[model samples]
Target chain A: MIDHFALSQAFGLLFASFEPWLWVVPGLLIGLIFGSIPGLQISMAMAVFLPVTFGMDFLQAMLFLTSIFTGGAYGGGVTAILMNIPGSSSSIATAFDGYPMARQGKHNEALGLGLAASVVGAFVGYVLLLLLINPLAALVLKVGPMEMVVVVLWGLTLIATLNDSSLSKGLLAGFFGLMLSQIGMSTTGVMRTSVGNPHLLDGISVVPAMIGIFAASELLRLRGSAYLVQDEAQRDIAFSRILRGVGETFRYPGVLVRGSLIGAVIGAIPGVGSSVANLVSYGEARRTSRTPEIFGKGAPEGVIAAESANSSSEGGSMTALLALGIPGGAATAVLLAAFSFHNIVGGPSFIRNQTEVVYSIILGNLGQVLLLAVIGLLMLRVLGMVVRVPLAYLVPSVLAMCAWGGYGITGTVAGPLTVAAFAALGWLMRRNDYPVAATVIGLLLGRMMEGELVRTLQISNGQPFNYLFERPMALALFVFMLMVLVGAPLLKALRRRKLQQAGR
Target chain B: MTTRFPATHAALLGVVLAISGFILWSAVSASTSLNNLVVVAPVAAVLGVLLPVILASALRKPAREDVGSGAWGDLLLLAGFSAFCLALTHVGFDVATFVFVWAGVVMSGGRGLWQPPLYAAVFTVVLVKGFGSLFPYPMLTLVF
Candidate 1:
């Protein structure tokens, strides 16, 4: 079952590619800076620098980008911990406990724990990519349209678990996002709601919309703030303490294992990213914890759970991308495009035909994880200094970057304008306490769901109920969805009743 | 105990429901071909929009006080800003961008007239001339 020759070749290629570590380090450093900075995403950084890799070998170019991805992901946690602001959407879950830990004067501990968890989680994900991705790819090859629909629905059900505020609110936001997605053309060769604009033919670009909603809105919110104070402090963190933090993470093996598994599963489902994985894992950890009340109050365990799951999604996500040629998240989508540009065909055949290349990628990812850990620890001392920069200066620079990045998406001013519009909408939604993730979920899943639903209907001759009922996987998914919708509330009620009875 | 729903929530929910109902009605009416508008559209439409609106109306009440102020002004400002940006595209990217940035800075609460003028000039000279040559095309197309 195992091909030793291919594996050896992969390792050889990986080792031989070390000369480009020169470019890799600088690229990672740049990615780290961008990731730590609010409004500058890894994609923007990669896109801006993609031209530099034009003359390099294909594998070298990929290694450089993957290094950036690995570094950027870890970099996002720096701002999240030191400042209240999350540097990226993936880091939002990190902020819940990480920021509180910082305010409580456990800044070094928080940073150490986050970095360690991120590196380990990424390693675990990379291992899965190496060992299981090929087999998974074989399975995915047999998936039909019906199976794809089930996968999409499974991904969408994640929104139910993302927002703890209210199910109705989250669902509503997701549905609204779906509706926004419908503003373009349908797969059926008909325009549903373009309102006669020729530009509407291609549908709204998710990147511009995401940039507008997350980055631009964040800038507007920071507009009137006085200078952002970078919190630079001289805290001596011992090597033993960092090791102990890593040890403490594994001490809660249940949490680590569960979080990793959740990340892997959620990562395999398209459109769901680290954000959803972090939320669900954190929620699950809270649900099962002996001291659930300690969550959101600088619990190191909480921080570990969230960060570990969040990073592990990267691993699970790559599995999906390489195996199915279906990207699990936006970053992976960019990676897919890069693969296409390199003339590397992804999918089930990738494992069989290009096993060496795939294994090389896996090995590269392992190297990236190790590099991120060492680099992150070294930068930890400086990040505390970086976070002290004033919000006033930071805000304008971020806004400018967002404006330029949005414009770069479509090479037009309209992209920036869309960013502004979405910013206003996001701000309003935040004010109303609606979950922004829900809207993004809707936007991401809307078109896929519609197309799948339409195709499923056509196959069954307008008999929707029969199709869902007849298909075993679809039926199971629907049942799973219902259970998820009801599970949280039921558990809460049961817990409350048990407490009431004990008191009486 | 007494329970009262807020008028704002009621109004918002009512609007959402109306919109969903209109879409559903349109879908049903527009179904000339069996494959065109099927049960999925209506089901998804009703489930996604109408259910949420109804749930929102049933579950929560709006606050008595108007929470968000300067609402009308903010909308007007946004509209005006968008219109101005669109208008700037015809004058070429450098000139338009300089004006756009300057105007944005001013509107964001910069006080001095000299600041806008100075920034505009600098942006034209540095950003327009310097950065413009670096990119592939003119920077001011309408993205939509």
Candidate 2:
């Protein structure tokens, strides 16, 4: 059923890619550094480097990008543990137990467990990618514009579940995102609300907007806080203790498996991304644990679960990207650009056509896991030193990087300005408990929804219901949306009731 | 007893009602024998207006305590920044960016005199040089 020769060829390509490991290592190192710093995200790093990657060979470019991605995922846990701040959105769940562990002088142990679990999780995800690419590609081919709209709507509804306080606020944030997305030109060639500005013709760049919202807003929020070095007591853990902690991770196989599966499923869904996966997995792990009371009070399983799930999301996201050509998240979207540059069109026909290239990506991803784990473990103390960097210096550096990234995208000042605007908006929304993820989902899916809606409308002439009821695929997607909206709340309520009864 | 209608719900409902009324009027005025805006804009408008109201109404209840005005200043600053972004296309990106960064720092309530000037100088230099190198293609200059 499988082409052994093609797989061998893919391995050869991957081995050949190692010849330029000099370039690859630096990219990985840079990604790691960016990922270790609070408020410095991989997407920002990718956006800044996007223009520079224009001249690189396909394999080299992909290796460089994937190295950044893999290393970044692993690196994000560093700050989440050592500091209360998350290095990236994906590491938010890690902060729950990571910071507590660090506070208890188990820094080395926490970091080691995180690195090991990340590697294992990534390995599992890669195996899943190799196994499922072909069948998944077939499924992806069946997705139409209407299906995409439903998917986006479903993703938006998840925000309602994500926010702890108010569903209305979350929905409002999502709608605002949808409205913001309407600022650019639509697929139907009509600009909805650009107010006659010609620069708005292309539409708002999601990268700059996201960077501003997450990174810049974070900096602004941190302005008044007193920045201090991590307590010196945290640095005293021995190597043997750390190793023992890592050994303890395998004892919790259930946590590892559950977290990885959650990561894989969430990463398979376009627009959801690893960050959401990490949070959901961490929450679920906490809920299901026998010692749920130990969850936020330095639980090693919590660190392992969050880090593994976050890292594993890369494999799942790549599977969706290579098999379907649809990017599962922002970072994967950048990878999609790299693929296009290499003339590698990823779609339902990709595995059948460019099988070797697809396999090479899988091998490269596996290579990255090995490289990051080894490097991360060996340099745990040295990497932990990043916490010493003053926020005043860190903040400016991040802002400058974000500004540079914004400028690179549109090659205009408007890009940086757009970043500033979005950053402020993001800060306010975050303050108000509005979910920024919802906005991102809305912005990402808005164009796809518009294109599908217009096409469906055109085909039906005047009857809107014809698109929903006439097409079986569309009908199925609609039903799926209904299930997501109704079922998720009911399930959540039931879980709450069960937990209450257990407490009683 | 707390009524089902919250203040946010009432506000959202009023906004939706107003939006619906405007859409209906616009649709009536714009409809023609050959083409109708009624078919295109009205349905989306009505849905957009009514859906928010219904959602707000369904979920609404009286607040126990006032939520903190945590980021109101940040919201205003963002609005101002959005305005500044609109200004950039007209005034040349360099000038607009300088003003924008400076204004943002000021509006954010930064006290240091050196901070604004320092950031402004850095931004202007980087933006001008960056734009010149990045866009080697024919520049589409915009003026207000």
Candidate 3:
């Protein structure tokens, strides 16, 4: 599985040439800007730059596209930490605590911590991917409907952990989100919740709705305020604080390792990429923390977990994309298109014949990760000044951008309308202390969960117990999910016992 | 949080219950399969009715501080964006962009009569031209 000769060739291909660098810089910039914007997306960035790579070679095109992927993945965390808004869906969990930290005048620290985690995640993900590309693809193929259902269930458990006020309320918010997500057409071609609007045939666009709930709602709530940070004295950008935040990422080795692994595995799973990986990792981090209640409030660990997982997923997604020709989500889908355009087919045959080429692409991305760190630091200093902008200017500007961004996605009035509706709904929910994050996550995973469950039912021929009995992996996954559900309290008790012994 | 809403209880419950019931009705009506009728339809009802009750119960009767004058800004937001959406489709992206941002700023209590317009024009041109050059397709075809 470990191909050293190809690795050498890959190194030679990257370090030996200067052609790929031409597009890498621009692609990264586009990714960073697009990814950091509230309503703009990484996929949209890639799609925009996709045509620019037409005349380039396979390696150049991949390098350029992957650089955008790398930059955008980290770029989202910047907005997430500074504003309560996530630049993209993958960074939603990043906002949970990052915004709270920002409220307390820790914006620089949040961005730094996010940057450090993203770099580490991208680094580890690519390194592991380089070594385990084939094995990772093999692992993805083994995942069946039952496994996907378990994954969705695992994702739902995070919702329970996110409710700050009441557990039932959290579950309710999550369930509400699930219902909201189900509004469009179902996998079975059944229209479940469109409310007679033909524009909602695809349901609400996730990014637009996210913009509404997180960005627009916050803007609405802070109507009288001048800026995001309420206190005027703490509004200035501090480089020292940002650097300290970078240094502080080392304090949570446990979060980084766990989050990165979760991201890689979830990201590699076709159709469930960074979107679920970041949220699932954040949920798990919150569930296992010594101070679980502080997660959505201002825990630096939450930002680490979410950003690390999402950034790492890029590498995990690539493992499948290069080895098995599978695009895990929107970003990788574009990558897969690049592969086809270059006449560079993927799958077993490509791996067997073009191992060196695959290695080169991986090597290129690893370098992109390193470049993103240097680039991210400089940009953070400049971008961190957004906190100083007055709300009157900031809010309306964001609103306009958000509306335009939604228009870019749906090309219809419905996109912006959906954003408006979600914004109002989210504002009401927020006012009442509802778990807005849970609602968003639930809406995201609803269709996915339903499709997987439907497939599981069809596979079992309605004999679900029998189906579970037959598959060892499914049974194991079910038990793991059960353990995840039960282990939190057990671990808490164990920690308490340890504390008692130490006190004695 | 205090409830400044005159009919906070009525409004909140009414909205949640009303939306839930509508969605449940739609799901059941559209559902032709057994899985949908048995599993999906029932789940929709529970989600609509049971959960909102849980949420409502989880909350107090509605605090006196629950609503604020800031909430009026929400209406302003809605109205501004609503007009923007319609204007972009009908008037033109450039014209709509200038108007939307200008109106949105003023509505949100932004000062400076000339500054808002200046910002809007520059933003519109930059966005239109920048995106227009990036890809092969026309980004603001309505404007051109």
Candidate 4:
């Protein structure tokens, strides 16, 4: 599995010129800034800056783009902790506990935990990429729409874990989000709930809606609070606490490693990216935790699980891009575009002839992870200042930024309109004890599930029952989902009944 | 044993079911083909069945009290957001952003007369100019 000669050549290529190293820090900084913003995505950041790489060589461009990928992965978690808003869908789970930590005046520690987990996760992902790049590429080729549907179903199980209050409310919120996702034209050329509007044909834009639901809704609730932290004294950003938080991850080495592995594997899958990986990792961490009850209630393990998985997904996603010429998501798609810009194609052939180049890219990313730890610490200090802004000023200003960002996304008023509408929905859902995160996740997965289900049906000639039997991977995943959905709860009830009988 | 009817929870449930119902109706009415209702219809049906259970569960438990300041305050903030969204196209993102910030600060209990406007102006300029340069499209602005 090890390529010593190529590895040595890779090192030579990287250090041969200081040109690539020069772009790494700047790329990471750009990614962090873009990913931290409410409406901006890491993909968008890369896309906007893709033109900048035109002047540079392929190695410089890859290093720069990958640096952004590394930085944005962690940067997305920053806002998720500082504010309730996740910088991107990938960081959604990070907000599960990170925001609660912020409210309890543990923002510095939460940021630290997230930063550390991200750094470690990315490092692990790259290491795994070095070992399993060939096998991962082969696995991606065998995955069909049936498997994609099952992957989405696995993600949907997260709604079950997300709801702390009413399970029914969580299910309702998630289904509602899925239904809302079907507003546009379907994969099969059928319109569901567009109401004859031309704009709705494209479906609700996820980012703006996400910003509305998470950021705007939380701000509405926070209208009463003077500041983000309830305690005034704890609001200060302490580097020591941040350092302590970093140290805390070593205590839960299991969660860190598990999250990293999950992220790498899931990230390698085409179409299913870090967004789903983080949720699945969070659910797994919650399920296996001794203190499962405190998951969404400011558990540091939750932060580690989420941040680790999301950051590591970058390496996993790179596997698909490098080995199969397939872009796992928008970010990788931009990377692929960058590849073509240099007249280099990504596939088995590219991996075969250019093993050293591949090693160089992976090695460059490993170095980027170290820089992220240092740069990210300073970033956390700067972004932790969001806690100091008064809610009165922060609310409308952020809301306006959401609106502007919404427009920046769709280049139309519909973006802001969706944000407004979803903000109202999110506020009502939150008020009624429903999980807005469930809805958000549902919205993210709904399109993928529907589109893939249709494809599965088409592939099976409208009879998926027989096709299900043929696809063992999909069948296995389905069984696992059932175990998670039914068996876990049934076992829990059995345990409860036995305890009651013993007490009697 | 007496159980209180959770009016608010029930109302929220009703809203959710109504939306689900609309979606279901649209999907079925538009095309009953298996492709269209493949995902949408099943989810809607599940939500329908789940609503009564949710209602029963809500009746069994005490409703969560609204922790927000008041209904009116939340509504006003939401209304302010809506107006800001609309004014972005009509007035300009800059002017709308300024008004929204000023109005939001005031609505959220900021009592200063000059401070809100000054803060709003500075924020709007910085936000508009900053994002305008960043974004590829031209932002509609009455005053730059």
Which predicted model would earn the best TM-score? 4
Q: Per-residue error at B144 for model 1, in Å? A: 24
lDDT of 2 by residue, B23-127 (tens): 334434434321223223433453476466655655554443322343455445456555655555566556665666676655545558788768766856764
Distance from true location, Cα of A411 in model 3, Å: 1.2
Candidate 1 on A1-504: residue-level lDDT in tens?
Answer: 457898999878877746645567776787787777644577767766677777777778777887877788878877677664455656666766786676565777788888878887888878876778867555444444565566566556655544435567667666666666665556686555444556656666665576666555545555554433223342444455555566677667787777777776666656556756776677667666777666666778777777888788888878778877887766777778788777777787887798888888778878878888877877777786533444433443345445554555566666666667676666565545566656666666667667777788778777877877777756775676557557765987899999999999
**Which pairs clash (backbone N, Cα, C closer than 3 Å) in model 4?**
none
Residue-by-residue lDDT tens digits, candidate 2, A250-344: 98999998888777755666655575678667766765577766876789889988988888788888877887788987788898888887778
> What's the alpha carbon RMSD for model 3?
2.6
Chain B TM-scores per candidate, in order, are 0.52, 0.55, 0.71, 0.85
lDDT tens string, model 1, B1-144? 123543444454554455445545544454545454543364455456546565656556643444334444344444544554455456555555555556555655555868666765565566445444344445653321
Model 2 residue A352 distance off true place after TM-score fit, in angstroms? 6.1
- Pitting candidate 2 against candidate 3, the one with the higher lDDT is 3
> DockQ of candidate 2?
0.12
lDDT of 2 at A418: 69
Kept native contacts, as fractions per model, are 0.08, 0.08, 0.44, 0.73
- Model 4: per-residue Cα lDDT over A1-504, one tens digit each: 878899999999999978879999999999999888877778888999999999999999999999998888888899899888888889999999999999999999999999999999999999999988998899888889998888888888898777858788888889888888888888888766787777788888998899899888888888877888879999999999999999998899999999999999889998898989999999989987889999999999999999999999999999999999999999999999999999999999999999999999999999999999999998888899999988888887888888887888888898898889888888778877899999999899999999999999899999898999999888988898789778987998899899999999
| Backbone clashes, each candidate | 9, 0, 10, 0
Model 3 lDDT per residue over A1-504, tens place: 678888788788887768877788787888898788765678878887788888999999999999998898888888888777787778989999999999888888999999999999988899889888888888889988888887877887788887767776677677777766767787878878776788888876787788777877777777677777878878878888888999999899999999999988888888888888898899888877878878888999999999899998888888788888878788888988988888888888898898999888888888888889888888988888888988787777777777776676676767677777777777777776777898889888877888887888888998877898788877898888788779757887899899999999
TM-score of each candidate? Answer: 0.74, 0.64, 0.94, 0.96
The best-first sequence of candidates by TM-score reads 4, 3, 1, 2
lDDT for position A18 in model 1: 61
